[model samples]
Target chain A: MSLPNPSFAPIDWERATPATLLERIAEAKIVGMGGAGFPTAEKISLTRKHPPNIVIANGMETDPDVNADRVLLEQHLNEVLTGLRIVARILSAVHSYVVTSHKKTIQVAQGCLNDNETVRYLKPTFQNGAERELIQILTGHVVKDNRFPAFDGYLVLNVHTLFAVAEAIAGKPLTKRLVTVHDETRWIDIATPVESILESSDPIRVGCYATGHRPRVNEVLTATVNAISTDKSVHALPCIHCGWCDEACPRDVPVESLFVMAEQLKPNLDAQDALNRCNDCGACVVACPSNIHLLDHVRALRQRNDIEWERISRATQARLRVDAREQRMRSDVIRSDTKRTERMQQQHKWQ
Target chain B: MAVTDRPKFQTTGIMVHVVIALLPGLGVGAWFLGHKVFLVVLVSILAAVATEAIGTRSVQTLRDGTAVVTGMLIGLCLPPSVAIWVPFVASVSAIALGKLVFGGLGKNLFNPAMVGYALVLIAFPMQLVYLDGLTGATALDVLKHQETESLQQLINHPAFGLVGAKHFEWMNLAFLVGGLYLVLLRIVPWLLPLSVLLGIAVPALVFLPLYDATYSFGSPWFHLFAGGTMLTAFFIATDPVTSPSAKLPQIIYGFFVGSVAFFIRCFGTWADGFVFAILLANAFLPLLEPKKVALDN
Candidate 1:
């Protein structure tokens, strides 16, 4: 496929400082575009202190149904490469890689890569697209227990996100993105209502079916939406306890039990842990024969945990406030007693 | 809405496949046992669906297809000559008491079919016996009754078929084919059914050699193909709701079910102990599923 002509002018890298570029990115309000929606400027600022050793342009669209990243790389290879160079230069990275599982995207990206940039092919798996998993695969170094890649000097940005960065730098102001709507990848502008794009009468999903959220009818498109689907509704059946969800979980979460707990609305501490570990990749949902929406259950459990945590924290704060008042009253009583004793002693001395 | 979110299969679809897989066994039973089997199946299904609808106060529950499955299973377990009302009562009780009272479908602790069969087995034992006016001592019953007969003599008995039991072996083979279809379709896990078969066969193998002139308990093939063994292994005992969900637990549960049924057949009063054996294994499901209690909490 012929590469799309770069709509935005090339960044004047020699004249522009990292701070000015970051400010312009912030002004453009460019987010991660990798479904996380984290602001690009904040991510770049976080890695500024660490001085990144490597920058990875993540094009591993592991969801079998999502092709936004692959299409973006195939159509706008130079723009994505230019974005990667700009980010790498800002981070002062020595090495840079464009990671993808798509053969066509890899071939086209390889042809576009400069001397410093290399194309890394990773076999498409559900978890391999995750920030931490991609970093671990590219660099044998683990991100080290609950820490993010940006904190560890590894700047892993999604290919679509970099394309957005390139656009933002060229003064496009992050208005449009390549979204896969019903398996067909196309450019969709932000703030375009979901109703306009979907022709189907089915309920709208904001992302790929596996990990997508059901959006309100009037909700507008956002930068992070990589895919949209008007899939038919699945009539959920009772779980047959097949343990397929457990087998499909990338994080070894007890998905079956978690589903049970979520259904019963009695999530425990372990269920909370499972919910935390769930990356919302929807692998369990895909593997389920009964068509149980397992990811929805996990999200519900997380929401419940949040509410429970908030309640406990509020109670804790109230108790702390009451304890402080009681301590103050006790101190006042001691002070009054001391004053009374001192006045009596003075009166006795005067006598 | 996008098409990628759609599930590839539905629960109703799985039930439809299960019904399709069961056709071979149903066909064999109708051929050997007569048209009355179909009548029994129809009555049982109607009664089950009606009971579930009444109990849940929702006609929509019928669409899930579980009631039909439960009814069909109870019907399959009954003798061909059983009174038509027997299936109706058994199916109603299976849905109402065995399933609905315990919270319907996935929540039921015991296999509904086994519960229904066990209830009728206790309530109307006389009606269950004497299929077509022949003393309904299934081949296992005949083998159990043999005191001084050698293995060769037992094999030669009129109750014995070419390899296993007369008429019953073919029925078992039919059920085996149906069961295998379910396994290959991934509707039912292979581990549970295989373990259940192994559960019965291994004990019979170990004890078959001990069967000399005076104490012939039948061979592994006889036990495997004998009355209700294949049916219970595939249809009744392997019920996903009652059986253990995980692999290791499923294996142990299957073994427990098989061994118990074999022991009951040998020493107990029942001709085929599969019903009671499956119910017993169902009771142990909580122990096997250690996460169940934690998940409930």
Candidate 2:
């Protein structure tokens, strides 16, 4: 698949002033477009107050059937390099990395870099794709629960997200999304327009398919299309203590306890010990075959615990008021009954 | 207009919707079974409502009007020529034993109507299932007895024999229309009905091609129309508390039920497979949860 006119262009990589970088990102509204859809400009601006010494481009498409980031790395290597360089320059980071798992994609991206200074490739395993896990692989520090990589001057962005950031620096808004349509039944591979993908055919559905509204092709299919992922909000079944999800997680994280604790009352959930310990990595949610949105459940549990604590405190106050009112009513009833009996006795005596 | 914020498990609404939905079936039943079905249905509804009212008042609670609906459904499920007292006992058992003893209403584990039918089934199997010559034996009953009669011979019943089988056909239509209404109203998810319908249809269609000298597939249409399938797909099996909470799982649950009901009717212990299949699905629904994925942030 070679193009006749393949004159490649080089991207300018320089440490721009914070104001210039902010202007570039805001002009494009390129918040983190790839992963969570956070505004890229805003994230970059936040880095101005707290400078980062390292920038990592996330080219790992670890989601089982998703390949948006990997696709961009293979075909748009030069553009990706330029975007990674711009991101590094904006943050004024000394060490920059382009992380990926696909050997071909990494090789192509390396070819585009052409032995450029300050650009290196870090091969990622399944565990290394995680933001914190990648940080651990790069610099021997495993980010425990509650701690963020920004604290250690490390910021990771998906390759597509970085490309979007570069486009944002060039003043473009997000009007399109990359969708991977993998047909489980037919084995068809596609990277079609979002609308076309939505309208195409029925694929394997998961997640939100159970409880949320059924999605039509008319809707924007953001992620990959397969039985592995659903377009609807997921409904959780009551955990039957199989402990399979915990055992399956590669990170050795106990997703089942988190799910159980989220649904039922646990001693340590409310204490700082539990609340501050989440690493924000999605192993539990991924490892679960029940399609239980575990991290979402944990967040719900945290909110519920706060409400429960408040409710208990309010109930205690309410009980005291109820006791006083009941006592007053009992006394009044006794007084009235005595008067009624006396009147009845006097009337009967006369008769 | 905004969509009504109906409760997820609107047990009363479900019951009411079903009764209102059953009007066509009730009318057809009355027309074929004579005025007896009408009387039985009315009495069943009245007895059910009255019993529920008494139960509520005794407990000092406001009635939700669901018991009457259950009674009417039970009446709909029974033979028209049944004694008047039969429905009273059935309704009582449905509410008292099937429901209230289990903590009432949404707390019941089995379909209330099926529970009532089960009581009648065990206690008065003869009176409950037998109907002079007008009603004849049910299709499944014939299958269960393994009469070894040809399809042509089986269709010759005075009530159900092919030529004048209008009652059987009409009864199935009425139930189907009511079931469709429930689906259109979105009271029940489309998957359950569709899957069950397929569950019954797929095997029946296959067996129709393979139907031979020893075993008959019966009428596939008869299988869908006869017995409690319409009631089960739209009402009993759709019990939100007992059924799978999710749509995909619900569909799987429904398909398994329909398939089992068909199997039981064709090859297993009974002609009617609704109660047995539903109970079986209830036991295995926990194992069908869709696998969830963790997002790598």
- Taken over the whole model, the C-alpha lDDT of each candidate is 0.81, 0.62
What DockQ would candidate 1 receive versus the native complex?
A: 0.33
What is the alpha-carbon lDDT for the whole of candidate 2?
0.62
Q: State, as a TM-score between 0 and 1, how close model 1 is to the true structure.
A: 0.88
Q: Which docking class does model 2 fall in?
A: incorrect
lDDT of 1 at B213: 65
**lDDT tens per residue, model 1, B48-165:** 9999999999887788798898898888888879988999999988998899898776788888888898999999998786367443456776877874379898888877888888
Write one digit per residue (lDDT tens) for candidate 1, span A92-196: 788898988778777776666678888988877678888888888878879876787778888889898888788778756566789888879999988899768
Clashes of 2: 24
Q: In candidate 1, which residue pairs get closer than 3 Å at backbone N, Cα or C atoms, i.e. clash?
A: A209-B5, A229-B1, A229-B2, A230-B1, A230-B2, A231-B1, A231-B2
